[model samples]
Target: MHIVYPAVVSALLFSIGVYGVLARRNTILVLMSVELMLNAVNLNLVAFDVWLRDRLHAGQVLTLFVIVIAAAEVGLGLAIILALYRNRRTVDLDRLRLLAETPAPTGSTSVPGAVSPPSSGPGEGP
Candidate 1:
Protein backbone atom coordinates (compact mmCIF):
# COMPACT_ATOMS: atom_id res chain seq x y z
CA MET A 1 0.00 0.00 0.00
CA HIS A 2 1.08 3.57 -0.69
CA ILE A 3 2.23 5.75 2.24
CA VAL A 4 -0.41 8.34 1.37
CA TYR A 5 -3.17 6.11 2.74
CA PRO A 6 -1.80 6.18 6.29
CA ALA A 7 -1.00 9.86 6.00
CA VAL A 8 -4.56 10.68 4.97
CA VAL A 9 -6.01 8.64 7.81
CA SER A 10 -3.73 10.35 10.29
CA ALA A 11 -4.80 13.74 9.01
CA LEU A 12 -8.45 12.85 9.46
CA LEU A 13 -7.84 11.65 12.98
CA PHE A 14 -6.02 14.84 13.82
CA SER A 15 -8.88 16.94 12.45
CA ILE A 16 -11.38 15.09 14.61
CA GLY A 17 -9.16 15.65 17.63
CA VAL A 18 -8.98 19.36 16.92
CA TYR A 19 -12.74 19.55 16.68
CA GLY A 20 -13.21 17.71 19.94
CA VAL A 21 -10.78 19.94 21.76
CA LEU A 22 -12.55 23.05 20.54
CA ALA A 23 -16.14 21.87 21.02
CA ARG A 24 -15.87 20.02 24.33
CA ARG A 25 -16.19 21.97 27.58
CA ASN A 26 -15.37 19.09 29.90
CA THR A 27 -11.68 18.93 30.87
CA ILE A 28 -11.50 15.13 30.61
CA LEU A 29 -12.92 15.14 27.09
CA VAL A 30 -10.37 17.75 26.06
CA LEU A 31 -7.59 15.54 27.39
CA MET A 32 -9.03 12.55 25.52
CA SER A 33 -9.05 14.59 22.32
CA VAL A 34 -5.40 15.46 22.83
CA GLU A 35 -4.63 11.76 23.24
CA LEU A 36 -6.45 11.03 19.99
CA MET A 37 -4.27 13.55 18.17
CA LEU A 38 -1.13 11.94 19.60
CA ASN A 39 -2.34 8.50 18.44
CA ALA A 40 -2.82 9.82 14.92
CA VAL A 41 0.72 11.17 14.83
CA ASN A 42 2.00 7.86 16.16
CA LEU A 43 0.18 5.97 13.40
CA ASN A 44 1.72 8.18 10.73
CA LEU A 45 5.17 7.73 12.22
CA VAL A 46 4.93 3.95 12.32
CA ALA A 47 3.58 3.75 8.80
CA PHE A 48 6.39 5.86 7.42
CA ASP A 49 8.95 3.89 9.40
CA VAL A 50 7.82 0.67 7.74
CA TRP A 51 7.92 2.20 4.25
CA LEU A 52 11.34 3.81 4.62
CA ARG A 53 14.45 1.99 3.29
CA ASP A 54 16.68 3.17 6.14
CA ARG A 55 17.74 0.58 8.74
CA LEU A 56 17.92 2.96 11.66
CA HIS A 57 14.07 2.99 12.21
CA ALA A 58 14.09 6.62 13.31
CA GLY A 59 10.35 7.01 12.87
CA GLN A 60 9.58 3.93 14.94
CA VAL A 61 11.89 5.09 17.72
CA LEU A 62 10.21 8.48 17.76
CA THR A 63 6.79 6.84 17.91
CA LEU A 64 7.89 4.82 20.95
CA PHE A 65 9.05 7.95 22.72
CA VAL A 66 5.78 9.68 21.85
CA ILE A 67 3.79 6.82 23.36
CA VAL A 68 5.80 6.97 26.56
CA ILE A 69 5.29 10.72 26.85
CA ALA A 70 1.59 10.41 26.08
CA ALA A 71 1.19 7.98 28.96
CA ALA A 72 2.88 10.37 31.36
CA GLU A 73 0.72 13.25 30.11
CA VAL A 74 -2.50 11.30 30.64
CA GLY A 75 -1.49 10.31 34.17
CA LEU A 76 -0.67 13.89 35.14
CA GLY A 77 -3.78 15.26 33.44
CA LEU A 78 -6.06 12.85 35.30
CA ALA A 79 -4.53 13.77 38.63
CA ILE A 80 -5.09 17.48 37.93
CA ILE A 81 -8.68 16.90 36.82
CA LEU A 82 -9.41 14.87 39.91
CA ALA A 83 -8.02 17.57 42.15
CA LEU A 84 -10.02 20.28 40.38
CA TYR A 85 -13.25 18.30 40.57
CA ARG A 86 -12.74 17.58 44.24
CA ASN A 87 -12.13 21.19 45.07
CA ARG A 88 -14.87 22.74 42.89
CA ARG A 89 -17.42 19.88 42.85
CA THR A 90 -17.86 20.33 39.12
CA VAL A 91 -15.80 19.81 35.98
CA ASP A 92 -17.61 22.19 33.70
CA LEU A 93 -15.42 24.98 32.33
CA ASP A 94 -18.24 27.50 32.54
CA ARG A 95 -18.73 26.79 36.22
CA LEU A 96 -15.00 27.02 36.79
CA ARG A 97 -14.97 30.48 35.25
CA LEU A 98 -17.76 31.59 37.56
CA LEU A 99 -15.78 30.30 40.51
CA ALA A 100 -12.78 32.27 39.43
CA GLU A 101 -14.70 35.54 39.26
CA THR A 102 -16.40 35.18 42.63
CA PRO A 103 -14.87 36.91 45.59
CA ALA A 104 -13.43 35.02 48.52
CA PRO A 105 -15.64 34.17 51.49
CA THR A 106 -15.59 36.29 54.60
CA GLY A 107 -13.27 35.15 57.42
CA SER A 108 -11.58 32.65 55.10
CA THR A 109 -7.90 32.51 55.92
CA SER A 110 -7.08 31.01 52.53
CA VAL A 111 -7.90 34.31 50.79
CA PRO A 112 -5.03 36.55 49.67
CA GLY A 113 -6.06 39.41 51.97
CA ALA A 114 -5.85 37.07 54.96
CA VAL A 115 -2.22 36.28 54.28
CA SER A 116 -0.92 39.74 53.46
CA PRO A 117 1.26 41.41 56.12
CA PRO A 118 0.32 44.66 57.79
CA SER A 119 1.98 47.76 56.37
CA SER A 120 4.98 48.89 58.41
CA GLY A 121 6.34 51.89 56.48
CA PRO A 122 5.18 55.52 56.76
CA GLY A 123 2.15 56.47 54.59
CA GLU A 124 1.49 52.78 54.02
CA GLY A 125 -1.41 52.38 56.51
CA PRO A 126 -4.96 53.52 55.77
Candidate 2:
Protein backbone atom coordinates (compact mmCIF):
# COMPACT_ATOMS: atom_id res chain seq x y z
CA MET A 1 0.00 0.00 0.00
CA HIS A 2 2.51 2.57 -1.07
CA ILE A 3 1.48 6.24 -1.19
CA VAL A 4 2.19 6.33 -4.92
CA TYR A 5 -0.64 3.89 -5.65
CA PRO A 6 -3.35 6.05 -4.12
CA ALA A 7 -1.84 9.20 -5.53
CA VAL A 8 -1.86 7.78 -9.02
CA VAL A 9 -5.46 6.64 -8.65
CA SER A 10 -6.52 10.05 -7.38
CA ALA A 11 -4.79 11.75 -10.26
CA LEU A 12 -6.53 9.52 -12.79
CA LEU A 13 -9.92 10.15 -11.20
CA PHE A 14 -9.36 13.89 -11.22
CA SER A 15 -8.27 13.84 -14.84
CA ILE A 16 -11.35 11.92 -15.86
CA GLY A 17 -13.54 14.29 -13.93
CA VAL A 18 -11.97 17.25 -15.63
CA TYR A 19 -12.55 15.71 -19.01
CA GLY A 20 -16.17 15.03 -18.19
CA VAL A 21 -16.76 18.55 -16.98
CA LEU A 22 -15.19 20.06 -20.04
CA ALA A 23 -16.53 17.73 -22.72
CA ARG A 24 -20.02 16.98 -21.50
CA ARG A 25 -22.93 19.14 -22.66
CA ASN A 26 -25.55 18.05 -20.17
CA THR A 27 -25.72 20.00 -16.92
CA ILE A 28 -26.33 16.89 -14.81
CA LEU A 29 -23.29 15.19 -16.26
CA VAL A 30 -21.18 18.25 -15.49
CA LEU A 31 -22.40 18.17 -11.90
CA MET A 32 -21.53 14.49 -11.65
CA SER A 33 -18.07 15.25 -12.97
CA VAL A 34 -17.58 17.89 -10.30
CA GLU A 35 -18.57 15.31 -7.70
CA LEU A 36 -16.01 12.93 -9.13
CA MET A 37 -13.32 15.56 -8.77
CA LEU A 38 -14.34 16.15 -5.17
CA ASN A 39 -14.23 12.43 -4.43
CA ALA A 40 -10.74 12.25 -5.90
CA VAL A 41 -9.68 15.02 -3.53
CA ASN A 42 -11.17 13.11 -0.62
CA LEU A 43 -9.20 10.05 -1.65
CA ASN A 44 -6.00 12.07 -1.71
CA LEU A 45 -6.77 13.51 1.70
CA VAL A 46 -7.25 10.08 3.29
CA ALA A 47 -4.23 8.64 1.55
CA PHE A 48 -1.95 11.42 2.76
CA ASP A 49 -3.47 11.29 6.22
CA VAL A 50 -2.67 7.60 6.49
CA TRP A 51 0.79 8.04 5.03
CA LEU A 52 1.69 10.84 7.42
CA ARG A 53 0.37 8.92 10.47
CA ASP A 54 -0.98 12.10 12.01
CA ARG A 55 -2.32 11.64 15.53
CA LEU A 56 -5.11 14.16 14.97
CA HIS A 57 -6.40 12.39 11.84
CA ALA A 58 -6.71 15.78 10.22
CA GLY A 59 -6.92 14.25 6.77
CA GLN A 60 -9.92 12.15 7.62
CA VAL A 61 -11.61 15.09 9.36
CA LEU A 62 -11.03 17.31 6.37
CA THR A 63 -12.28 14.56 4.09
CA LEU A 64 -15.49 14.45 6.14
CA PHE A 65 -15.90 18.20 5.77
CA VAL A 66 -15.37 17.97 2.01
CA ILE A 67 -17.97 15.22 1.81
CA VAL A 68 -20.47 17.41 3.66
CA ILE A 69 -19.84 20.30 1.32
CA ALA A 70 -20.11 18.04 -1.70
CA ALA A 71 -23.47 16.79 -0.45
CA ALA A 72 -24.81 20.30 -0.05
CA GLU A 73 -23.51 21.27 -3.48
CA VAL A 74 -25.18 18.30 -5.09
CA GLY A 75 -28.48 19.14 -3.45
CA LEU A 76 -28.49 22.72 -4.62
CA GLY A 77 -27.09 21.91 -8.05
CA LEU A 78 -29.72 19.27 -8.73
CA ALA A 79 -32.50 21.57 -7.58
CA ILE A 80 -31.36 24.28 -9.98
CA ILE A 81 -31.00 21.83 -12.84
CA LEU A 82 -34.46 20.44 -12.17
CA ALA A 83 -35.97 23.90 -12.18
CA LEU A 84 -34.24 24.77 -15.45
CA TYR A 85 -35.39 21.55 -17.03
CA ARG A 86 -38.98 22.18 -15.98
CA ASN A 87 -38.97 25.63 -17.48
CA ARG A 88 -36.73 25.17 -20.53
CA ARG A 89 -37.30 21.42 -21.20
CA THR A 90 -33.58 20.86 -21.75
CA VAL A 91 -30.36 20.93 -19.75
CA ASP A 92 -27.86 21.55 -22.49
CA LEU A 93 -25.35 23.97 -20.99
CA ASP A 94 -24.77 25.80 -24.27
CA ARG A 95 -28.46 26.45 -24.83
CA LEU A 96 -29.24 27.45 -21.28
CA ARG A 97 -28.70 31.16 -20.80
CA LEU A 98 -30.27 32.51 -17.64
CA LEU A 99 -29.25 36.09 -18.29
CA ALA A 100 -29.83 36.20 -22.02
CA GLU A 101 -32.44 38.66 -23.13
CA THR A 102 -35.69 37.34 -24.56
CA PRO A 103 -37.32 38.72 -27.68
CA ALA A 104 -39.96 41.37 -27.39
CA PRO A 105 -43.64 40.42 -27.32
CA THR A 106 -45.57 40.09 -30.56
CA GLY A 107 -47.21 43.05 -32.35
CA SER A 108 -44.54 45.46 -31.12
CA THR A 109 -43.07 47.84 -33.67
CA SER A 110 -39.59 49.40 -33.61
CA VAL A 111 -38.90 51.46 -36.65
CA PRO A 112 -35.77 53.47 -37.31
CA GLY A 113 -36.16 57.25 -36.81
CA ALA A 114 -39.59 56.77 -35.29
CA VAL A 115 -40.40 58.80 -32.19
CA SER A 116 -43.69 58.74 -30.33
CA PRO A 117 -45.00 61.58 -28.20
CA PRO A 118 -45.22 61.04 -24.48
CA SER A 119 -48.64 60.90 -22.85
CA SER A 120 -49.63 62.93 -19.76
CA GLY A 121 -50.52 61.33 -16.47
CA PRO A 122 -53.63 62.07 -14.38
CA GLY A 123 -52.06 64.92 -12.40
CA GLU A 124 -49.46 66.00 -15.00
CA GLY A 125 -51.12 67.09 -18.24
CA PRO A 126 -49.29 68.55 -21.24
Candidate 3:
Protein backbone atom coordinates (compact mmCIF):
# COMPACT_ATOMS: atom_id res chain seq x y z
CA MET A 1 0.00 0.00 0.00
CA HIS A 2 3.02 2.28 0.30
CA ILE A 3 3.31 4.91 -2.46
CA VAL A 4 7.00 4.16 -2.84
CA TYR A 5 6.30 0.66 -4.13
CA PRO A 6 4.34 1.73 -7.18
CA ALA A 7 6.56 4.77 -7.77
CA VAL A 8 9.71 2.67 -7.89
CA VAL A 9 8.16 0.04 -10.11
CA SER A 10 6.86 2.70 -12.46
CA ALA A 11 10.27 4.31 -12.64
CA LEU A 12 11.91 1.01 -13.53
CA LEU A 13 9.34 0.25 -16.19
CA PHE A 14 9.75 3.75 -17.64
CA SER A 15 13.52 3.39 -17.75
CA ILE A 16 13.36 0.09 -19.59
CA GLY A 17 10.89 1.60 -22.04
CA VAL A 18 13.25 4.50 -22.72
CA TYR A 19 16.09 2.10 -23.42
CA GLY A 20 13.94 0.03 -25.75
CA VAL A 21 12.83 3.10 -27.67
CA LEU A 22 16.36 4.45 -28.02
CA ALA A 23 18.37 1.26 -28.62
CA ARG A 24 16.06 -0.85 -30.75
CA ARG A 25 16.42 -0.73 -34.54
CA ASN A 26 13.10 -2.39 -35.30
CA THR A 27 10.05 -0.11 -35.60
CA ILE A 28 7.69 -2.62 -34.02
CA LEU A 29 9.88 -2.86 -30.94
CA VAL A 30 9.92 0.90 -30.73
CA LEU A 31 6.11 0.97 -30.67
CA MET A 32 6.09 -1.59 -27.85
CA SER A 33 8.49 0.58 -25.90
CA VAL A 34 6.14 3.52 -26.21
CA GLU A 35 3.35 1.35 -24.87
CA LEU A 36 5.56 0.38 -21.93
CA MET A 37 6.16 4.03 -21.14
CA LEU A 38 2.44 4.73 -21.26
CA ASN A 39 1.76 1.84 -18.89
CA ALA A 40 4.33 3.21 -16.48
CA VAL A 41 2.48 6.53 -16.47
CA ASN A 42 -0.82 4.76 -15.85
CA LEU A 43 0.66 2.88 -12.93
CA ASN A 44 1.93 6.07 -11.36
CA LEU A 45 -1.41 7.77 -11.84
CA VAL A 46 -3.28 4.97 -10.06
CA ALA A 47 -0.72 4.81 -7.25
CA PHE A 48 -0.93 8.52 -6.58
CA ASP A 49 -4.71 8.42 -6.79
CA VAL A 50 -4.89 5.76 -4.13
CA TRP A 51 -2.31 7.49 -1.99
CA LEU A 52 -4.09 10.85 -2.03
CA ARG A 53 -7.55 9.50 -1.24
CA ASP A 54 -9.22 12.29 -3.16
CA ARG A 55 -13.03 12.33 -3.31
CA LEU A 56 -13.08 13.28 -7.00
CA HIS A 57 -10.51 10.62 -7.98
CA ALA A 58 -9.09 12.85 -10.70
CA GLY A 59 -5.90 10.83 -11.00
CA GLN A 60 -7.78 7.63 -11.77
CA VAL A 61 -9.98 9.45 -14.26
CA LEU A 62 -6.91 10.81 -16.02
CA THR A 63 -5.42 7.34 -16.04
CA LEU A 64 -8.48 6.11 -17.90
CA PHE A 65 -7.97 8.87 -20.46
CA VAL A 66 -4.35 7.83 -20.84
CA ILE A 67 -5.38 4.25 -21.44
CA VAL A 68 -7.80 5.33 -24.15
CA ILE A 69 -5.15 7.46 -25.82
CA ALA A 70 -2.63 4.64 -25.60
CA ALA A 71 -5.05 2.31 -27.33
CA ALA A 72 -5.56 4.78 -30.18
CA GLU A 73 -1.80 5.30 -30.45
CA VAL A 74 -1.20 1.58 -30.77
CA GLY A 75 -3.79 1.29 -33.50
CA LEU A 76 -2.30 4.20 -35.49
CA GLY A 77 1.26 3.07 -34.90
CA LEU A 78 0.63 -0.42 -36.23
CA ALA A 79 -1.04 0.97 -39.33
CA ILE A 80 1.96 3.19 -40.04
CA ILE A 81 4.41 0.33 -39.43
CA LEU A 82 2.46 -1.92 -41.77
CA ALA A 83 2.43 0.74 -44.46
CA LEU A 84 6.17 1.29 -44.12
CA TYR A 85 6.86 -2.44 -44.25
CA ARG A 86 4.82 -2.78 -47.41
CA ASN A 87 6.58 0.11 -49.09
CA ARG A 88 10.15 -0.65 -47.92
CA ARG A 89 9.90 -4.45 -47.39
CA THR A 90 11.47 -4.09 -43.92
CA VAL A 91 10.74 -2.16 -40.72
CA ASP A 92 14.34 -1.64 -39.68
CA LEU A 93 14.83 2.01 -38.64
CA ASP A 94 18.34 2.16 -40.09
CA ARG A 95 17.16 1.07 -43.54
CA LEU A 96 14.46 3.78 -43.38
CA ARG A 97 17.17 6.46 -43.54
CA LEU A 98 17.21 6.12 -47.29
CA LEU A 99 13.60 7.33 -47.46
CA ALA A 100 14.98 10.85 -47.18
CA GLU A 101 17.63 10.39 -49.88
CA THR A 102 16.87 11.01 -53.53
CA PRO A 103 18.89 8.75 -55.78
CA ALA A 104 20.71 10.28 -58.74
CA PRO A 105 18.93 9.31 -61.95
CA THR A 106 20.05 8.95 -65.55
CA GLY A 107 16.88 10.69 -66.76
CA SER A 108 16.77 13.88 -68.82
CA THR A 109 15.86 16.09 -65.84
CA SER A 110 19.50 16.40 -64.73
CA VAL A 111 21.41 14.92 -67.65
CA PRO A 112 24.80 16.46 -68.45
CA GLY A 113 24.79 19.72 -70.41
CA ALA A 114 20.99 19.99 -70.42
CA VAL A 115 19.92 23.63 -70.04
CA SER A 116 17.05 24.31 -67.64
CA PRO A 117 14.48 26.89 -68.71
CA PRO A 118 14.48 30.09 -66.66
CA SER A 119 11.60 30.56 -64.26
CA SER A 120 9.13 33.38 -64.94
CA GLY A 121 9.18 36.13 -62.31
CA PRO A 122 5.98 37.29 -60.61
CA GLY A 123 6.12 40.57 -62.53
CA GLU A 124 6.36 38.82 -65.94
CA GLY A 125 3.03 37.81 -67.56
CA PRO A 126 3.00 34.48 -69.43
Candidate 4:
Protein backbone atom coordinates (compact mmCIF):
# COMPACT_ATOMS: atom_id res chain seq x y z
CA MET A 1 0.00 0.00 0.00
CA HIS A 2 3.04 2.24 0.26
CA ILE A 3 3.39 4.95 -2.42
CA VAL A 4 7.04 3.99 -2.72
CA TYR A 5 6.19 0.72 -4.50
CA PRO A 6 4.29 2.33 -7.35
CA ALA A 7 6.83 5.14 -7.57
CA VAL A 8 9.70 2.72 -7.95
CA VAL A 9 7.89 0.75 -10.64
CA SER A 10 7.05 3.95 -12.47
CA ALA A 11 10.68 5.01 -12.40
CA LEU A 12 11.76 1.69 -13.86
CA LEU A 13 9.19 1.82 -16.62
CA PHE A 14 10.21 5.34 -17.51
CA SER A 15 13.86 4.39 -17.63
CA ILE A 16 13.18 1.51 -20.00
CA GLY A 17 11.04 3.73 -22.18
CA VAL A 18 13.81 6.30 -22.41
CA TYR A 19 16.32 3.64 -23.33
CA GLY A 20 14.05 2.28 -26.04
CA VAL A 21 13.48 5.70 -27.52
CA LEU A 22 17.17 6.50 -27.55
CA ALA A 23 18.51 3.14 -28.70
CA ARG A 24 15.88 1.80 -31.11
CA ARG A 25 16.40 2.42 -34.83
CA ASN A 26 12.81 1.67 -35.80
CA THR A 27 10.37 4.56 -35.61
CA ILE A 28 7.56 2.25 -34.44
CA LEU A 29 9.67 1.13 -31.51
CA VAL A 30 10.30 4.73 -30.57
CA LEU A 31 6.56 5.38 -30.62
CA MET A 32 5.97 2.38 -28.37
CA SER A 33 8.65 3.69 -26.05
CA VAL A 34 6.86 7.02 -25.81
CA GLU A 35 3.64 5.16 -24.93
CA LEU A 36 5.48 3.28 -22.23
CA MET A 37 6.77 6.52 -20.75
CA LEU A 38 3.28 7.97 -20.82
CA ASN A 39 1.95 4.88 -19.09
CA ALA A 40 4.56 5.26 -16.37
CA VAL A 41 3.33 8.80 -15.86
CA ASN A 42 -0.25 7.54 -15.70
CA LEU A 43 0.67 4.98 -13.05
CA ASN A 44 2.30 7.69 -10.96
CA LEU A 45 -0.71 9.96 -11.29
CA VAL A 46 -3.20 7.29 -10.19
CA ALA A 47 -0.99 6.20 -7.33
CA PHE A 48 -0.66 9.76 -6.07
CA ASP A 49 -4.36 10.38 -6.49
CA VAL A 50 -5.14 7.33 -4.37
CA TRP A 51 -2.54 8.32 -1.80
CA LEU A 52 -3.77 11.90 -1.43
CA ARG A 53 -7.44 10.87 -1.37
CA ASP A 54 -8.40 13.92 -3.41
CA ARG A 55 -12.14 14.68 -3.50
CA LEU A 56 -11.95 15.96 -7.11
CA HIS A 57 -9.56 13.22 -8.32
CA ALA A 58 -7.52 15.68 -10.39
CA GLY A 59 -4.66 13.25 -10.87
CA GLN A 60 -6.93 10.61 -12.37
CA VAL A 61 -8.54 13.23 -14.59
CA LEU A 62 -5.17 14.34 -15.88
CA THR A 63 -4.26 10.74 -16.50
CA LEU A 64 -7.31 10.38 -18.70
CA PHE A 65 -6.26 13.44 -20.68
CA VAL A 66 -2.82 12.01 -21.13
CA ILE A 67 -4.28 8.76 -22.40
CA VAL A 68 -6.37 10.63 -24.95
CA ILE A 69 -3.35 12.53 -26.18
CA ALA A 70 -1.30 9.38 -26.38
CA ALA A 71 -3.97 7.70 -28.49
CA ALA A 72 -4.03 10.58 -30.95
CA GLU A 73 -0.25 10.63 -31.08
CA VAL A 74 -0.09 6.92 -31.88
CA GLY A 75 -2.63 7.26 -34.67
CA LEU A 76 -0.89 10.17 -36.33
CA GLY A 77 2.58 8.77 -35.80
CA LEU A 78 1.66 5.44 -37.34
CA ALA A 79 0.06 7.17 -40.30
CA ILE A 80 3.23 9.09 -41.03
CA ILE A 81 5.43 6.02 -40.58
CA LEU A 82 3.26 3.96 -42.90
CA ALA A 83 3.37 6.68 -45.55
CA LEU A 84 7.14 6.80 -45.35
CA TYR A 85 7.42 3.04 -45.57
CA ARG A 86 5.23 2.98 -48.67
CA ASN A 87 7.20 5.72 -50.41
CA ARG A 88 10.78 4.75 -49.53
CA ARG A 89 10.33 1.02 -48.64
CA THR A 90 12.20 1.04 -45.34
CA VAL A 91 11.43 1.74 -41.71
CA ASP A 92 14.97 2.00 -40.36
CA LEU A 93 15.36 5.46 -38.86
CA ASP A 94 19.03 5.78 -39.84
CA ARG A 95 18.34 4.71 -43.42
CA LEU A 96 15.36 7.00 -43.91
CA ARG A 97 16.86 10.34 -45.00
CA LEU A 98 13.96 12.09 -46.63
CA LEU A 99 13.60 14.13 -43.51
CA ALA A 100 17.25 14.54 -42.68
CA GLU A 101 18.04 17.62 -40.62
CA THR A 102 21.32 18.32 -42.38
CA PRO A 103 21.38 20.26 -45.60
CA ALA A 104 22.00 18.38 -48.85
CA PRO A 105 25.55 18.41 -50.24
CA THR A 106 26.01 21.35 -52.63
CA GLY A 107 27.60 19.23 -55.35
CA SER A 108 25.00 16.47 -55.14
CA THR A 109 23.05 16.12 -58.35
CA SER A 110 19.47 14.93 -58.80
CA VAL A 111 17.93 15.02 -55.38
CA PRO A 112 15.29 12.38 -54.81
CA GLY A 113 12.02 13.13 -56.68
CA ALA A 114 13.61 16.15 -58.35
CA VAL A 115 12.44 16.64 -61.94
CA SER A 116 15.18 17.12 -64.48
CA PRO A 117 15.07 20.08 -66.85
CA PRO A 118 13.06 19.30 -69.97
CA SER A 119 15.06 18.55 -73.11
CA SER A 120 14.70 20.91 -76.08
CA GLY A 121 12.06 19.45 -78.43
CA PRO A 122 12.72 18.93 -82.18
CA GLY A 123 10.37 21.82 -83.05
CA GLU A 124 12.07 24.26 -80.62
CA GLY A 125 15.26 25.98 -81.88
CA PRO A 126 18.47 25.54 -79.89
**Which candidate ranks first by TM-score, i.e. highest?**
3
List candidate 3 stretches off by more than 4 Å. 99-103, 108-126
TM-score (all chains, Cα) for each model:
0.76, 0.78, 0.79, 0.77
Residue lDDT tens for model 4, 9-93:
9999999999999999999999999999999999999999999999999999999999999999999999888766654556788
What lDDT tens digits, residue by residue, belong to model 2 across residues 1-126? 899999999999999999999999999999999999999999999999999999999999999999999999999999888756555557898875546434546744321111222232121233
Assess the local accuracy of residue 35 in candidate 1 as a C-alpha lDDT between 0 and 100.
95
Q: Higher TM-score: candidate 3 or 4?
A: 3
Q: Tell me the spans in candidate 1 whose CA falls farther than 4 Å from its real position.
A: 98-126
List clash counts for every candidate, in order: 0, 0, 0, 0
Tell me how far the alpha carbon of residue 125 in candidate 2 is from the true structure, in angstroms, after superposition: 32
Worst 10 residues of 2 by lDDT: 112-121
Tens digit of lDDT per residue, candidate 3, span 1-126? 889999999999999999999999999899999999999999999999999988999999999999999999999999888756544557888766542324457543321212222343221135
What 10-residue stretch in candidate 1 is worst by lDDT? 109-118
Per-residue alpha-carbon lDDT of candidate 1 for residues 80-105, written as tens digits (9 for 90 to 100): 88866545556766555542324656
lDDT of 3 at 96: 62
